[model samples]
Target: MRIYISADMEGVTGLVDRDDVQPGGRDYERGRRMMALDVNAAVRGAVAAGASDVLVNDAHGPMRNLLPEDLHPAARLIRGRPKQMGMLEGLVAAHDAMICVGYHARAGALGVLSHSFMGHEIEDMWLDGRPVGETGLAQATAAAIGVPVVALTGDDVACAEATDWDPSITAVAVKYATDRFAAELRPEDDARQAIEDAVSAALAAPLAVPEPAAGPAVLEVRWQSASVPATLAGLPGVTATDSRTVRAEGELPALYRQFGVWMRVATALTNQPPYC
Candidate 1:
């Protein structure tokens, strides 16, 4: 079976602050190594579970957090940004399953370093009228592509979020949140082992891929700045929901791509540190 892994940094083992995940921060180097190790654990599990191929997507900010040299040799990496699908880049229907590693909870959640696609620019997001964070959106997009998200690794809050979105997914929590930037972390070895074991068991008997959605999908975003919505409104099929919000309608994957464009536009217009 072919497997895809999307790796984000915030919920990575032992990372509880932006300093750890963002470039130029004192601990960013250590954080990236930690991120790669978590992904490697998943890669090892996938290979042991009979995966013939594995693709890893560096799905955090700047999209260059994972170095090719640091990843498991069995896994090929999708690194860099401007990817149409953002965090879900390199994901396709042909992949048997997708595993999300080191993902945090949605914006405003108490999970460590929790935020949506953007640090604070995106206030909230809704897909098909259901509130969703990275977890839900990724799962929805994979489902639309006829791929199942078999497992996820993150903080306790992120794990709970994933389970709430789809109980079939196996979620392994490496930390328990005390605040957005504070967590009670598990030992690195213990956390990695949990990730590896959970991924192996989940992929051993993967869930059936859902049928691709036949109807149009709606994506709505509430931005922190009104200028973002005003600017995004100029895009075709995008409607201004209010002063600080915009809504778009299209099919899945396409809708997902449009959201990426909207984020880039917002990033260009705003100048604020993430998690501010």
Candidate 2:
């Protein structure tokens, strides 16, 4: 079986603040190492579960966080940005399953370093009228292409969010959130072990790939800046929901790609840092 792993930094084993995940932060180097370790654990699990191929995507900010030399030898890495699918880049129907590693919660959530695609720029998002976050969006996109999200690893809040999106996904919480930038972390070794074991068990079982939506999915985003929506409204099929929000309709993966365009537009118009 082929396994795809999307690795994000915020919810990695011991990260809790922007300083931990952002490039210039004092602990960013250490954080990236931690990120790689968490991903390696997932890679090891996928291999143990009979995966014939493994692809790991660096899905965090910059998309260059995971070092090629640090990744497990069993896995190939997709790093860097401008990817059409963003976090879900390199994911396709041919992959048997996808595993999300070190993902945080949605914007305004209490999980460590919680934020949506563009940090403060995106206030909230809805997929088919259900409040959605990174975890939900990724899961939905993968399902659209016939790939099952078999497991996820993150903080307690992120794990709960995953369960809310799809209970069948095995969620391994590496930390318990105390606040947005704070958490009661599990020891690194213990957390990695949990991630490894959970992923192995999840992949070892029967995987269920949800049927793709029959019709188009509606995507709505409430942005912190009205200019963002105003700018995104220019995109085909995108409409201004309000001064600060926009909505669009399209098929899965395609809709997912459109959202990436929205983010780029917002990034060009906003100057706020992700954690501000």
Candidate 3:
């Protein structure tokens, strides 16, 4: 069996503040190592579960966070990007199941460091009129490519959100969110063990592909600033619903591509300082 794992940092064990996820922040190294550990745990689990192939996607910012020397020898890692699927990159027909490691809850969720893609500018995201977070979007992307999201590891809120998307999905919460930036963390070793066990069990089960949404998917992004949405209004099939909301209607794959474009545009606009 082949398993795909998407790893993000904010929901990794013991990470609570923005500094932990930022590249230059004092805790960034710790966060990166913890994320690598978490991914390795999942890799071990998949191996133990009889998976013949495992692919780990560094899905966080810049898409190049995992330490190559420290990663599990059995698993291959996908790093860097501009890929068609952002977090869900490298997903293909051969992957039997998918797991999201260290995933947080949606933007504005109670989970620690909660935010969807482009946390700095996007207020929230909705699919087919229902609000969904990164995990949901990731699940949809997996489904579009015919892979089931069999398991996920994150904080309490993220696990709950996963279950809401697919109740049968196995979930391991490494921490319990006290709020957006604080959590009562489970010990690092304990969290790793739990992830390993949960992943093993999830992979052992029958593939339960999430039911795809009926009809064309409509994705709406609510921006932190009205100007951001306005700027995206001219894109084909993208409509500025209001001052702060942009809606894109199309097949799931197409919509996802558009979302990636918006994220890159907005991130570029906000992450730079004026030249003069």
Candidate 4:
């Protein structure tokens, strides 16, 4: 079976903030290695479970966080960013199941380094009005391609959030959130073991790919500012709140993807870094 693994760095074990996730910081390299280790654990589990092909998409900043040499020799890696599918790159109709490793909740979520596609662009995203994080968006893409999200690993909040979106998947909570910025970490060995165990469970009992609510999907976003919503509303069918938000109702995956472009554009225009 073909399995797709989407990897992000924020929810990685032992990571706490921006420096660890960015390109030129002291903690970045070490944090990336930790992410690679977690991904390797997933690959090991996928191999053991008899998956014929495993694809790892490095979806973190610059989209090149995981080191290629450190990845499992057996798995193919998808790195770099700004692709047609975004974090869901390397996924296709042939993929039997999907796994989100090191995913955190969206910005404003009570999870470590929580942010959506971009720090402030996606204030929040709701599919059919149900709140979803980046993980949920990745799941939506998988669903669109008829693939189910079979496993996920992160701190407690992330796994908890997944239950609402993908209740049937395996969840491994290797850390516990102390707050949005900090967590109660597991010993390295335990965290690595837990990741592999969850992957094994996921492969043994894959969830049925549910219909990803063919929208009339309404994505209501509350950005950190108001100006961009004004710019985003210029897109057809996109609506702007009086001041601080943008809402796009009556949209489907295709249109939502376009709508997401507006969100990113606005975020880039408004980005001030250091959270303001």
Tens digits of per-residue lDDT for model 4 on 11-86?
8888877887788878888999999999999998888888899999998777888878999998999888576667
Per-residue lDDT of candidate 1, residues 1-276 (tens digit): 999999999989999988999999999999999999999999999998999999999999999989899989999999997798899988988999999999999998889999998999899999889899999999988999989999999999999999998898899999999998899999999999999998999989836977766799889999999999998899999999799989988988888888888888998999768999
> What TM-score would every model get versus the actual structure?
0.98, 0.99, 0.95, 0.92
RMSD of 2: 0.7
Which portions of model 2 show Cα errors greater than 4 Å?
A: none
Candidate 3 wrong stretches, greater than 4 Å:
272-276
Q: How far is candidate 4 from the true structure (C-alpha RMSD, Å)?
A: 1.9
TM-score for candidate 2: 0.99
Q: Which ten residues in a row have the lowest lDDT in candidate 4?
A: 251-260
Q: Number of clashing residue pairs in every model? A: 0, 0, 0, 1
What TM-score does candidate 4 reach?
0.92
Error of 1 at 21 (Å): 0.3
lDDT of each: 0.92, 0.92, 0.86, 0.79
How many clashes (backbone atoms < 3 Å, residues ≥3 apart in a chain or on different chains) does model 1 have?
A: 0
- TM-score rank, highest first? 2, 1, 3, 4
The candidate, 2 or 4, that scores higher on TM-score is 2
At residue 159, candidate 2 shows an lDDT of 96
